[model samples]
Target: NEQISKYAVQDPELEGMGTTCVVVMLKEKEVFFAHAGDSRLYLLRNGKLAPLTKDHSRVQEMIEKGEITPQEVLSHPERSLITRALGMENVLEPEIGQSFEAGNGDKLLLCSDGLYNMLSNSILEQILTENAAAQDKAIRLVQRAKDAGGYDNISVQVIEFQFKEQKIILPTTPLNFFEKNIDESSENISPTIPKVVKEKKIVDEEKVPKSEVKNTFQPKPEMSEKTPPAVKTGKKVPDIALIVLLVLFGVVLTLFFLGSGMTKDPKPSELNISQTPDTNAVAEPMNEEPLDNQQETTAITTPKKDEKPVTKPEKPKKIPKDTLISYTVQAGDNLRKIAQRFNMKTETLKKLNRLDDNEIKTDQKLKIKVRTVHTVAAGDVLSRIADQYKTNRELIKKANDMTDNATKRGTKLIIPLAKAE
Candidate 1:
């Protein structure tokens, strides 16, 4: 309203010129709406048409106060006299309707008073309930309203909710023993039992004697009484040969140590020096070169001072910048929607378009800042794409005007990069 008042102050012609406003936002399974004046929102579900908003008109107030009935609202003398509307006052308060749960095959209708004023609820319901596309229904409604009287401007917007069906999968049952080709004896045994138990059972059955298997009892073995017992000798003998060998080894070791100590070390003067370079030997003489000749050799090996040093060339750096593109406002488009489409804030969009409020009209041209374009490929997701571009998922979604994280293959998307500080 402050924006509107400012506009009105700038241009006197805009003074007292107000309009109705109605906005509907659709989500995965919910619907939200806000409105001012007589433009309304309706929902059609399961062939039942229900109004989601009430008008801020004098006839509506009268009906609420019991001075008139809802059926008479169409014919009331002050039916067009709205109690509230955009630009009607310095302060504007739009009725923000509560969000409601949405379902598959639901149809939402948003139209100006011009539509409901000509067509009754029954007529509107009958048309919306027909099996037709949202566009067709909107066209039919407008045509019918024009046919009725065409007393005012007609504007209609139709939105259809489509939800993907969910498929339930049941758990599978285990195969029977016959189908699994398992032995009947093994079927009764628990799978958790250790393999050692089965192996031990087989060994015990094999080791059982035939007589013991037939009878339930077995006798213990005993030695015969006449059997003779062997006895061990109690006398101890010394190892004389081992002692004699130990004495011989000690005498030999003592003789070996005494012989090693008796040996004398060789003196350093008696050491051999056959391979050493003898200083006493005569030295060979060589021809000496001139100082000038040596200087010439050094000059030949030196590089020229005029040669320039080699250095690598530097590559140019490319700085990223924001790009501006034109966008045409389509049906159901608003300033907020356009802002999101370009991955920008609403205030930024408003500032770019120099709009003082959120109001926008169909077919209006908008300027959008796009960093680049990306063609979605197979296995592409919002998060992965955002990471690849060094951005965020929300920014990508807003730039592409996507409500969900789903991305279609081969779809061209506008990537909006944030401005560098």
Candidate 2:
């Protein structure tokens, strides 16, 4: 209210211009809100609708005083007369509601008086509890209000709470050493069992009596000495092959280095032959030949004294005209801010909006006179673009809000043009 009053004092045309405000903030599972005037907030939980705010209007005061009932508010002529509103006083008090916990599947509705005045509470509750998206519910509510008798501007917002569930996964148990060995040996026995286990089993069997031993374990036939030598030969084959590969690789590297050295050695010799005329007799004649050929070419291509030079006429460029577009005022927007966004002056924006002062409200639609947009291309400078459009370079810079002459390729710039006669 203080901010609005300051603005109103600066512009006398905005002295009586004020609006009702309702602000709601949702953080995690909590809702916080504050409001003035007849704008309201509602909550729908488990198919039950409840009001979260009360209107600060004359009708509300009368109802509190027991002079009028709730049903009589719809037909009351003083229902629209708000006792509290923004910009109405220098020092004002707004009703700040307490924070409330929200739950999953809960729906919240925030709207202006235009909506509730046109539609009843029962209709609003039905719309809030509908099985539809939030955007759809808001649209339906506004459309219903407009259909009924939307003498005032209708605004509505719907929010639904939905929490997601997370899943947790547990790891499996690991196998023991003996169990792992047994499981692996089920497929193949000899290679899987450890040598220590085999030795322990044999020693245990020896301690048992001869009659009780029962030959439970069987031993495989022993490998001959020739088989060991063949195994050593198999392992040594890869070593011999690796040694041969190393020798071949070393030879290739040596050849590569030698070839590079040979290529480099001739470059210095060629440069020396060209630089020193007395060093090579053949190089001196080759260098002098191009000089004589250049003199002959220059003598042949000289222009005649009587020949006239021809020039072509330059073509004119087509200047782009300015266009008009519709822009909607958003929350926290002012005339200066909106004008700066489109690279325009505040006075020009006010003229387009047909406003005597810099007062604007949320969701207000205004006309914007957009200038010609030029996309910067390779080799495009501010001066060149200005010359092409027959305008001043400084004007172009100001229209595009440029701080310096530097313009990057593909950057769209607004070109301010003179008003068409």
| Cand. 2 Cα-lDDT | 0.54
Candidate 1 per-residue lDDT, tens place, 16-131, comes to: 45677777654435565667777877777777666777777655555554666654644433344565666654345566667775665677889886676567666777888776
User: How displaced is residue 186 in candidate 1, in Å?
Assistant: 92
* Residue lDDT tens for model 2, 168-237: 1222323232255676566753322222211111111112111111112222223244222111212122
TM-scores for all predictions: 0.38, 0.39
TM-score of 2: 0.39
| Candidate with maximal TM-score | 2
**lDDT (Cα atoms) of all candidates against the true structure:** 0.54, 0.54
